[model samples]
Target: MKPIKNVCVVGLGTLGTQIAIQAAAYGYNVDAYDPKPDAFATMQTKVKAAMQMTRKGPTFPMALWDAHAAKVRLHSSLAAALLTADLVVEVVPEDVESKRKVFAELDRLAPIDALLATNSSSIPISRIESVTTRPEKCLNIHFYQPAVGMNMADIMGGSKTSPETLQAARVFVRSLGCVPLMVQKETLGFCFNSIWRAVKRQSLYMWDGGFVDFRDIDRAWMTFTGMTYGPFFLMDLVGLDIIYAIENIYFESSQDPRDAPPASLKQKIARGELGVKAGIGFYKYPDPECTREGFLLGA
Candidate 1:
């Protein structure tokens, strides 16, 4: 396995920021890229808030927060970000054309030895690899949001991805103190996400079909699974817009009417009730019921 020192993260959104912060906190030099100047303007503040939130879990050293934050360099261009990267984790928007465009650029500008990975939750690495010359080096490295707390990433490869690349990715993830959940074959949504998609699909169905209240669904889930949050809560945390897009990917993959995202979800998106970011979704946030242990546990 190659010794990874410099990690390049392409995107500055939620998952991207988490990945970038975790990499830096682990002493790796991280270069992050985003097209928006506004995104860059508040990068430090976002990182600080993320770090503070994650610090609750004692995930990263608080004493090193500033130093680690400093290790991350934000770039406006892909070429600049990929310059010295040993591993490139692309967390760009989850669209086929968008991901393909980033891969094409990465394949052209990044070092030949740099391993390429995507933080995509739904799209398979094979689809994205078609745009790159180095299919063997491209793989998926999907991370749960608040990655530092989760400490898990799903590593999968395309049809052409070599065993060597998979192992290298596993080593890289381990180096960051995160567990690597390997996808044995090319599977949509990898491992945990596949299961998560089911829960989300059903939750949306229940809510849209008028079968159950979203809060009740979460209550049953938390009580049965012993998890702090349920599908609706997770969907809100992930943002309804993102959830809709992922559902669309699943729908496109299966073409099953059941896999189709609920129309209510689209309506929510239209109204700007995009979950926690919008301060309203399945539940009101900034103080969602799911966040309260007493509410979740019925205490």
Candidate 2:
């Protein structure tokens, strides 16, 4: 309800850190809380690598990113971080209960009028909103990897989300230099994420069914789209463990056997193959095969 000048980000994981950085880049005062001791340090290392590897894309320059990344305040306690927040975004894991716990805590700590949002890629705020008293003030402000040039956000509301809240959120997204993709109706996966989910599902199905090699699939996608990375490569960046969790969410929602995650994927996660963070997933990090010039040509 206020001007949304100060933003509090709970859970400084991958996207959490990026959101904080993007907000700060636009001159918004940002405070974040994460139990992980090295969350801020890890975010710096991860974002620096991402900027270096990404030769193109993302409108902001390196200096801007550096300047803001340095200013994002990371705090040990959620209460301290939420003290002056006009907006509080929960970026915890994808699980519903985890989100509910965070949302309840955020509701208790954040200012009465401060907007509470979830960066959950799939789970709607509706499912998680009731935990807090102000359902009208709670909404889903899902973000893609903004640091990588996917500079757009899905702005979806719960059953009780107010129109004023929605407009303010759109303005907030724009303030961060991102397009607000307002979802007209409630959906499991918001806008581009739903489409991406389909691609991911089919890609995994084909790979798991032994119908085609994953590498060949990536090549096909890269060649067709003329993009730097393909589905598998992008999935690796999204993290294999995260992909598995998202897939399981779909499977649980539909109760469809075909939607279930493959056993091999589980095995990979069990071995700590979490993608770029773990240094090995679909491919090794620091120099994934997909980043090589010869990848498209099958070299």
Candidate 3:
């Protein structure tokens, strides 16, 4: 429960990198690790770019970059990163087996007293804890996308997760200026994803029913909800592959037809038309000079 000084973020993907950056910004010594050399290199470059921008005044992307570059140490080796870490956060992929493998290795590498956490959105904390010896310290610390900006976080406890462990996680999340919602019972998808699944089901139903097109559905939702973007638009930004993966998880775990993604989504995934990152999805981004309309089909 004491203040976490040295933090290790295992998995330097999009979410892990963001979490490490946030921890560094809060003055915590952060060591970010990933197996891939290229990923580590990318994070190091990104952190340096962010720091340079921070030194400069607010200038569009530079301001944004500086905001991200505050406190991060990039590492390629798990052993090296965890040697000095008081807390270890596993932000690997959502697959249960993959998470178990990471947790097992972390258990072997990290200090005995080091608090271990997972950034998994849907996988149950109990399942993850079952793989590690330190079940009392293993828990879920789900951060929303743009973890640095999202103030809301979900802290889920397995059956063996100690109360002190939960308290420590709450304190750590608060230190980062984020609100931690304590979940006593760990469930698949937890709170956010459970709500999101419902919303996704309803949206897909409407789309499949021929009641609306993608654009109309997006416009209606944005106009009524005051959100920056509609569900489809957000999905596009999140990548169609990820959306498919999450939906597949939900469907497999719950056996709920509602959680099943539509055929159109399946087709998109099959075609490798992943969203913004890949330049095409429900919409497209032909080039930097292209207009939004140009990204739409038959515009």
Of the candidates numbered 2 and 3, which has the greater lDDT value? 2
State which candidate has the highest TM-score. Answer: 2
Lowest summed lDDT over 10 consecutive residues: which window, candidate 3? 51-60
lDDT of 1 by residue, 41-149 (tens): 3644544543342233326665665666667898878799899988999988889899999899999999898999999989899998989999999999998864326
Instruction: Find the 10 residues in a row with the least total lDDT in model 2.
Output: 50-59
Q: Write the per-residue lDDT of candidate 2 for residues 186-294, one digit (tens) a residue.
A: 9989888999999999998898889998999999988898877788878877889889988898888999999899988899899999888888888887888878878
Model 2, C-alpha of 270: deviation from truth (Å): 1.0
Candidate 1 TM-score, true structure as reference:
0.92
Tell me how many residue pairs clash in candidate 3. Answer: 1
Q: Give the TM-score of candidate 3.
A: 0.84
**Candidate 1 ranges with C-alpha deviation above 4 Å:** 38-58, 62-66, 297-299
lDDT winner, 1 or 2 = 2
Model 2 regions lying over 4 Å from their true place: none
lDDT of prediction 2: 0.88
